[model samples]
Target: MRIIISPAKKMRVDTDTLAWHDLPCMIDRAEVLYDKLASMSYDELKRLWKCNDAIAALNVERLHNSDLRIRLTPAILSYEGIQYQYMAPGVFTDEQLIYVQEHLRILSGLYGVVRPFDGVTPYRLEMQAKLPIEGAKDLYGFWGSAIADQLYQETDCIINLASKEYSVCVSRHQKPGTRFITCVFGEEKDGKVVEKGTLCKMARGEMVRYLAEANAKSPEAMKDFACLNYVFSPAHSDESTYVFLQKKSQDSEE
Candidate 1:
């Protein structure tokens, strides 16, 4: 089994972390996109990133100076989003880290798909970015089946923890034999499963940690995940979707 999660926009370049690995498998492909991004003017970049003055300037600078092959941080240590914060991969034991390396995959606009230990640099591309490259209409078109092909090379069962944007790239191109299961984290509100943004992110992160610690080998193992008061609801789940819900009050306090 393998798990796929979304890459975060909030990133940091930390040299303090000793764990590092070679560049992502699609580094060459990333360089091609980098070149396209680099050719755009600052104003164009601002438009591409859809950011404020500060963020746009920072990313423009990053695009100007960043090298895919040079300065790098482990993908696990780089992302600082709410999901990554909850996962707290830095606190994981060596065995858990190994499990993550073998089982987790990060969906990225820049790198396509990243392993936990893959070396990465700071960038500001989202999967939904509108940058039309070569003959392709957008990032999704440029990626096509490459991401799914890579995941299929790794494992047949994919536990998708990524958001819809990144997840579509995989779901659309899944191999015939692939088993894709999506875990839904939410609260049962008025008898309906309601997914709030922050709670869902927290649950997704905690679920990753749970999987790593338990060395989960199948989707059925995920039903045992009880982090942050989330409990599996079989009645709300189907064959391809697993629903884990917390109480409304329990989510509000967090």
Candidate 2:
């Protein structure tokens, strides 16, 4: 069993070596996207969505375990202008937060707001939750109820459950304005290996299909599992959809 926490070569936010203009430009880019989407026609919006999806796939290529299933949408605004909407990893709760903190207390990196320099940490209040063995329905219920009230405007990102017992994770790190992918793999325990894989390119419609399969009572292929993985399903990119995992690799003999 081997556990590895490998940093993405090009994360959503690579702060340590960041240039002075990086953060500002990144923020501006998000807002600019908001503005562009502010008045986008229906057809134009659809085009934008497809383009964003393509970009997400391209970005995922640089990292071993980043979420390729994440989505970027033309974020509608209230009194303001248009913004970006991240459909995946969208919901949260406080109990989930506490549980995440407790679970990641040992790993430390899994809890807390990413430091100013931790560009890769993405959104503030990044935390990890363990998948309850009870069942998927019960798990989401606990999570939705837990963070529903507490995660009002302050909270940013959440790292859902990973399949490996007590040793792995799949996350979505919120970026400055809108977000696409901010992923991480936490500590690995003995005899466990987190295998790295990804779904290179996908469309929103395709993602929806994969999600359906992933969440089925049982998935036949990694693609089906990818869709079901969600923000907290304890899984990553798969071909049926998009699922990445940090698991202990078995020998060829196995």
For lDDT, the strongest prediction is: 1
Name the regions of candidate 2 deviating beyond 4 angstroms: 1-32, 51-196, 199-251
Give the count of colliding residue pairs in each prediction: 0, 32
lDDT of 2: 0.25
TM-score versus the correct structure, for each prediction: 0.96, 0.19
Query: Which stretches of candidate 1 lie above 4 Å from their native place?
Result: 248-254
Candidate 2 residue-wise lDDT, 1-254, digit = tens? 01112121222432233221112113332233233334445444334334455443442232223321122111111001010111121232433322222221111121211111222222111122232222433223223322222221333322221222112232221234421222222223463424333321122212323333333222222233332122212443332223333233466328
What is the Å distance of residue 80 in model 2 from its true position? 26
lDDT digits (tens) for residues 1-254 of candidate 1: 99999989999998677557878999999999999999999898888888999999888888888789877899999999999999999899999999999999999999999999999999999999999997998999999999999999988899999999999998998888679999999887788888988888899999999999898889899998888888999999987899998844645768
Worst 10 residues of 2 by lDDT: 75-84
Mind sharing the TM-score for model 2? 0.19
